[model samples]
Target chain A: MDVAIKEFILAMVVLDAGKVQGGGCPVFHAENSQEQQKTSLYLARILDGVVHDLENGVLLICRH
Target chain B: MEKYLIAVIAGTVSGFVDRWLMLRSDYRYYPTYPHAYLTHLALGFIAAGLGAVAIPALAKPDYVAVTFLVLAAQQFRDIRNMERETLSNLEKTKLIPRGTDYIEGIARVFEARNYLVILTALLNSAVVYSLGWQYVFLSAPLCFLLSLRLMAGSHIGDIAKIEAGQLHFDGSILKVNDVVIKNVGLPAEREKILREGMGVIIKPIDDNARLTLDAPGQRMAIIHDAVSILGSKVDVGEPHFAPLARKQIDQGYLALFMLANEPDLEYLMEIIKRVPVLESTRGTTLSSLYGRKAAD
Candidate 1:
């Protein structure tokens, strides 16, 4: 990941963490826009990978 | 002979009234079993036969009175049993999953309530038979009216359940138990995300049906977790957020990464919307153009 993307991802991590700590609720409605729908699909796909990697200890996050 | 005719008239009239009340009432489900409806008619005929057989056999009206009183007591007990069954059903349905099963519960309750109404009619028949013909005629209509009131109360309870999102249409189909459910997600935590990943889970409030979407990569893993959260036999599928286009693959990856961090459905939707347009024109053209247009 690029420095910028990593930083952006890091910001999101912090934001999500705040929500969890604050007892924030999850969203349920379907996406309205095509772009958003695509991004959502992509994000779902990636997390899908991370979950797999974490399962097998293949994640490169520590090395990175 | 005349007394028997009177008893039969009273019982038959009350039975008809009870049936009409149940059919016309707005109770979501009938509490009475269909067999109870048949029982009402049978009771009417039997009451008439008993009146004929017993009234002449005993010269004193007091003996006939005792007979009616005993019958009324028996019928009342049956009514109570019916009411207990209805309440039990309500309790059982409260535990039933809201959705399709909920509707089924409503139907079951409705049937039970209708049965109670029939029991009331039977009691009224006994009371009317005990009274002489003139009084029997009067009692029958009054019993029917009371049955209506009982139904009205049950309907009110039904409406309350419908309003609490505890009841609604399952789809295009309008059904009693089909309830609209909103599943709110808890924002992900850092450690939790590391363990569970970013994803949204949808679960039916009452049943073992659930859908979990982990942010893109190993979505299957999230599905596995959902299998346990929702239990067995739930059909799991992926969330169709976007198309797998070739050009925006990197943007897709970025969106997936962001989703892993946030995993909030609304936020994910907003970010995902920006992905394609952001990817287009080197990720800045449309917003810049709009910004310039606003400035100009």
Candidate 2:
């Protein structure tokens, strides 16, 4: 639950729960489409987390 | 003889009339498949029949049949359980889940409905047999409409004032009106809300309203309705652009933010106004305890 990061690592890979697929460095699994959209914005924009989609429900979220 | 027959007819008619008029396919729909309908309908008929026949059975100088009414009560409770189970199963598969409180409320209504059916039937039968069959034309519709009126409960609009709010960001924090929704530190996400974001601020009229709207599950339901009605503009990967209900619990106010396909403020406000008060999240201390204090 504590998603806090410290002494930032260059890149780390995390599995998405919602199964949204993309090229983002760290993809998140959102409960539904609306949630997926919010997660995309938060991780990709604010957190500077890369957000991309793959045909697989997996979305990739990573740090830029 | 013929009087008893008419009593039975009136009772059964009254019960079915309740079912027919009140049964609807809407946002909080009960499964309307033929199987579901037929099952409830059949149970309703038997309940009506039991109520109608109670007079005759008692007239026959047999009191033991009164026990049947108790059995019928038991049966009705089972119907509530059955309803809750089915809806709970269906919730698992839904894109926007109706929360547990909402589901339980629907289930309770389903169960309570059968008892209403029985009450209507019994009252009509008693009137027909005791007064005369002629009274049924007047009594049946009265009972049916009464049941319908009884079924209505609280709506969001009843307790809150809803107005469209502007979506703005200070730095990266998103604000719907004065309420800070979340710290959206992302520039792209902030831009999306400011450009495409539409929102509503719901201010509770009193403490009761505050208590009812405070539940996270209830707020989620409101957000779900807004999104389902307005349609989220963003697609699969856009988590930040999704509809959200951000609440100020102490202040008894909540704000909705969304990047909707059609950004109609009035329409979205109307949709939020109609969301039903969830069953499980039923009562509030505000109406009684807090209400008196606030008035004074």
Candidate 3:
């Protein structure tokens, strides 16, 4: 696969991972104020996971 | 002015039909899909043209009346559909916001425009009835222009409200709530040759910072306006970083858009990853992230 194409797929795969795992975080659906706050924190964590992978260029593969 | 009137009629009818289709249970959130919105608008325009030509040939008044009735009835039927979905939770791409009551507001505007069109047509047609066919013909087109002007203005207003954070972009903000990275890039020698309003901002990796921000329209302009007024400061991150500010939503969502898409997505992300996410979220930066990369 071309370098760009490979990179594209990897990036897409990572995003899809976040979308699938997002599953409406507990804080995203929390009823109580505290639970809601916690849900927001959890949501942040999920986003962090997604962002970290994207920044590292983890999806890109270059031929050595 | 005549062409403008034609555009008005076309736009009004287009806006109404656009709203009608959008109000459907399966379709309320559809407009956020830029491709889908364009498709629907084309469809609406075709329907109006067909009605204008074919209806006059067939039953004349009844044809036009039925078209209005069908459009109006469809919108009304979708009111209950609105109750089924939590408007705030749904996010449709970057153009429209998720939490705001856009569907309802859009529907209300469409209905108001519909009545305006019908009322104007009726009054004009009635007055023209004693005159000549030319007069009645003129009436239909006239009402259309009025409706179009109103619809365009309303769309512009909706865009403004979104920027003000009076409308959408809430869900994304709630999710990626923190300010992670910031960077500012000055307009290089190349950008000086580019258009009047253009610049860039770069941020680090800990933030896919791009995927989060997309918003309604007018606010996008406000951000553009701010960038133009503040010069390099806009790019450096001065005012946009403000909580729920229009540019805040725009910048974040833009980063998200530039980050998530394929091909060109990498272009923006590369710049964002290299540059530091600046503190103030103001100042003008480089003209184009990837554009410069290609030249290099």
Q: Can you give the TM-score per candidate against the true fold?
A: 0.30, 0.78, 0.31
In terms of docking quality, model 2 is: incorrect
Q: What is the lDDT of candidate 1?
A: 0.33
What TM-score does chain B get in every candidate? 0.31, 0.89, 0.33
lDDT (10s digit) by residue, model 3, range B28-120: 233455664554445444444433332232334356655665575455334334432433334333232423334444444434443443444
TM-score (chain B) of candidate 2: 0.89
Model 1 chain B worst lDDT window (10 residues): B205-214
Scoring each candidate complex against the real one, what DockQ results?
Answer: 0.04, 0.07, 0.03
For model 2, residues A1-64, the per-residue Cα lDDT tens digits are: 3466542322222344534334323434466655665665555555544444443444445442
The TM-score between candidate 1 and the true structure equals 0.30
lDDT score, residue B202, model 2? 92
List residue ranges in candidate 1 displaced over 4 A: A1-36, A39-64, B24-119, B154-296
Tens digits of per-residue lDDT, candidate 1, B1-296, equal 66545554555555655655555222222324576446544544443343333433343445766576457535533544554454445543332122222233334444444455445445554565576656655766676677567554311111111111111223221111222121111112223323423322222121111010112222222222222222322112222111111111211211121113223445433322222110011122224656446433
Candidate 2 local lDDT, B65-102, one digit each (tens): 87877776687788878887887788766655667777
Identify the leading candidate in terms of TM-score: 2
Q: Candidate 3 on A12-56: residue-level lDDT in tens?
A: 222123333432222123334344334333432343221112231
Q: Against the true structure, whose DockQ is highest?
A: 2
